[model samples]
Target: MTSVVPVLNDSMVAGYLERFITEELHSSGFTEASIAVSGGLDSAVVLKLACDALGTAHVHPVFLPYKASSEESRRDAGAIVSACGLAWTELDITAMADAYVALEPGIDRLRTGNLLARLRMAVIFDQSKKEHSLVIGTSNKSELLVGYSTWYGDMACAMMPIGDLYKTQVRSLAAFMGVPQQIIEKPPSADLWTGQTDEAEIGVTYDTLDQVLFLLVDQRLSPEEVAQQGFEAGVVRAVERKIVSSQFKRVLPPIAKTSQRTVATDFLYPRDWCT
Candidate 1:
């Protein structure tokens, strides 16, 4: 009922994230991590956390930009790499994306954008293998909950340092970590197409959307209860629908329950089991 927005202690979260990254990497027997810096608040925060967690030497940041990507994306991403003195590489996926686009000349932005996202992930995974590091993800709780991410694309990662943090919380942590003000102030975007902002694509401001998500997901409130609390019934329904529809993106592909220990069915092993 109350329109109270969720607040996070940036300092506490920064420390917690730093420790989480270290522990996750250590348990996996990997001392290094590869991250795809998208020049957004979320990735910038993750980049800073990776540096604090494993040191500059252990963090490898890759800037994956395409032709449609804004120039600021590269500049902002490069600044983080320079500030941390971390070694990074850039991979221009324009040609690769064009190859697919050529197949379907009228392909919509969503399809092309998804292709680009997957290409970026493919490159990040390749770099991970080459650097002997795990792929660190930058997806936030807000995006993950609403399926605002691409499955096996931007959603792919060995471990997500900020997975539990919401988009608003990411901005808070980014400020605490001293990420560039430009990145923090800019409208959130995946940069899939020119002038495409995340809020515009999602059709709702993150402030309101996050509140709805917190009530529905974190507070375990039903859609009706959330609407009764003052949120628009339409907005509550939209958020709830996204959470249900996008559930598939949050987990491993389902396996048939034919065997006693089917993978991702009855048989699930901890990611650190091998370690």
Candidate 2:
């Protein structure tokens, strides 16, 4: 059988996502959007879509960097700001992150990285409130499926225009939007620490992961079935484990069903209650 993942029409996806974002924000009574950009392809694509959705003036691009973040990342972020003529905000989060580190001098790299991610989200939300804007999300489906995202950190957002797109599709859309080649060609990273690349940490390139995920997730294949398609058993198992374990991060905090109409239980309703 041919690959289940359909070849994307970049232009159509871009138009669809941009319209989705603009319409959702307007319906929510928010005329502005604030997004944190890491100078990575995902954020760059989001930045472009937001700017196209609601003009540059109404889109706020925030770059929150810690001390270990690469200089190249900063330059690339600046390049985007310049190219889009956006009023970018540079907030150095090094001091703040260090304070937490100091409190626990021997904390591991993973802990420190999570702190940095959450700190950045805090900054994004703060900026959104200051500008009366909604926090836009840049996470892609591959990250979401593989449990690669930091919960309540990078995952906390008022809206996620790119959440449904995989990392591969993100690149396709980014190229369609004329995102800088430097960004598109660079290795993907969260810039949480020195020499940290996402694929390295994940132990699989996005192209490989996305393919298996397309079979496992979108196609809803059994792990055995996916492995039968020539995927390594170890990889299929690992990917399935991630999707199962990360279920909490993908949903609302579960409330105890003590009452008959508990929120998130029987009382489920659209957040835009009136609309």
The 0-to-1 C-alpha lDDT of every candidate, in the order given, reads 0.89, 0.89
What lDDT does model 1 reach? 0.89
TM-scores across all candidates?
0.95, 0.96
Q: Which is the leading candidate under TM-score?
A: 2
lDDT of 1 at 198: 91
lDDT (tens digit, per residue) of candidate 1 on 182-246: 99999999999999999998888988888999889889999999899888999999889989999
Give the worst 10-residue stretch by lDDT in candidate 2: 1-10
Pairs with backbone N, CA or C atoms under 3 Å apart (clashes), candidate 2: none
User: How well is each residue in 151-246 modelled by candidate 2, as lDDT tens digits?
Assistant: 999999988898988898888888888888999999999888899998999888888788889998888899999999988889889888888999
